[model samples]
Target: MEGDGPGGTGPVHVPFGYIVASEKWRGSQLAQGMQGKIKLVFEDDLTSDFYLSNRSCILYVTEADLVAGNGYRKRLVRIRNSSNLQGIVVVEKTQMSEQYFPALQKFTVLDLGMVLLPVTSQMEASCLIVQLVQEQSKEPSKNPFLKKKRALLPLESCLLRTVQQIPGVGKVKAPLLLQKFPSIQQLSNASIPELAQVVGQAVAQQIHTFFTWSG
Candidate 1:
């Protein structure tokens, strides 16, 4: 929550869980206007200053901020994981590129959904922020760590571990398979055709044979 910033803006006192606007967004009307209304702070360089819980909700006004370079990208990744926040990067539609897509994927893997907004200006970005704030207010916030911890229930953990051991199944694919079949027992009980429907034929056959041998 602490970072370097210029003086004279005075101490910004926000209620606990208040949104902290990034210093980079000082130019935007929304940021400027909200200065006195909300508890806002200005930080040197951060993924996004306006966050619900740490990095739970971040707003990037430009794609350049995200695709700046390896150092910036790594910092973003760290923030994303540490806060498990929902990230929104605003840019023109034409600005999308293959180079940044991999970084987006990494964000997704951490369960931090990174959204790309093809917005033209701060006006549109501001509107989007209002909408998001409203929506976020409507829903109860869930802790990302608790959600991950819940997934480690004895039975569920064992099932996930067993499923990951299947040939051609890795961390990502194993989760997909679990979505289709909730338990390892059910997955093992499934027919080749049923398993194929979820994970394709070759891998399905491997899973079926592995379970068969174990049985």
Candidate 2:
């Protein structure tokens, strides 16, 4: 784990791997090429440093190895976002190690934003992360890469809006469903079981019932 410092300059010698954090895992499970030594800034005022998303790291790790209550047995291990780190990895077995401890209770886990670094023990390279974060906060990014925006569908036949026309969907659930499952054509072909997995069983049943009756 790194020290509590702004800009990089925290813990050094992050190991080759460790367990994955749940928050980092959730938002990044489907995304690819989001790994390696990219600079991480603490999103908002939460943690002091951010590294690569933990979920991305977990792709290389196994869930079974991540037992609850166990801290890094060694000093050079990478910190991750998980129930154990967040006080949620409940202990179901008593025979586990006595050293098993709960995670540091904190809000806003760090987000991994870049991937260009190899694990190193160099202090200067570690400081570079802090410098990058500090520099970023001082100047608005001029990089064209940072200025890109999400593309939206034209309003005329916007499938999202058309789905909103469904009865009982209303303002909230309609957009929620669209955001959850982006394509309307995908929604049309989605099995009730699949939709239920995205939404809840009850909501999925309602959506399937409505679409089946109407279409």
Candidate 3:
């Protein structure tokens, strides 16, 4: 559980690591968001007792590395993959409040062999950035309602959105199908003819069910 995991092992290195890249920002687009160099600090260990239900693979951050003159620190969580890939860390926490540490810009899992499972979008990540900034500004204990507002959709929404984005969906019909079938798994289970009934034979029949094929 200690050094056996990826990355390595040490006092500060156990569950922590320095940010090598800001996944949310890259090149010119990244520059627009943060004027200074963007670096983050993250955690990759579990805090409490272990269980099958508990997400053994998760990441957190205690602080961030910020550049001077840049009004904001690179306060974002990130995850890393084996193929030199990096992404934002998406963990469900009761409430993350660590604004006290100005130097702590970001909190996430270290670049270990952890793959960031896709469940939400960059838009949701943007909303989280706003919430994290606000939470850091005040005593986290005082605010509870913040938890209710869902910044990111669950796996169901993710699948639904992806399905709707197909070329022929346009805008109107996409929402219609998404509203009816909330998840890819569910949609996949449905018969092709059933989908054709909703989106019509030509379009629906032509669309291959990625989920069914994979399943």
Cα lDDT tens digits, model 1, 46-144, are: 545555432244445355554654444554555445423334444422244445644543343223333334455555555555545444445432423
Can you write out model 2's per-residue Cα lDDT over 142-163, one digit (the tens) per residue? 3332232321111111233345
lDDT per residue, candidate 3, 29-79, as tens digits?
222332332233333442211111111222322223221222221322222
> Whose TM-score is greatest here?
1
Between candidates 1 and 3, the one scoring higher on lDDT is 1
- The 0-to-1 C-alpha lDDT of every candidate, in the order given, reads 0.50, 0.32, 0.32
Candidate 3 pairs with clashing backbones? 43-60, 60-108, 61-107, 61-108, 64-104, 64-105, 75-105
Candidate 3, superposed: residue stretches over 4 Å from native: 1-41, 44-160, 209-215
TM-score order of candidates, top first = 1, 3, 2
* Each candidate: RMSD: 11.3, 16.7, 15.2
Candidate 2 RMSD to the real structure: 16.7
Q: For each candidate, give its TM-score against the true structure.
A: 0.43, 0.26, 0.34
Local error of candidate 1 at residue 29 (angstroms): 5.1
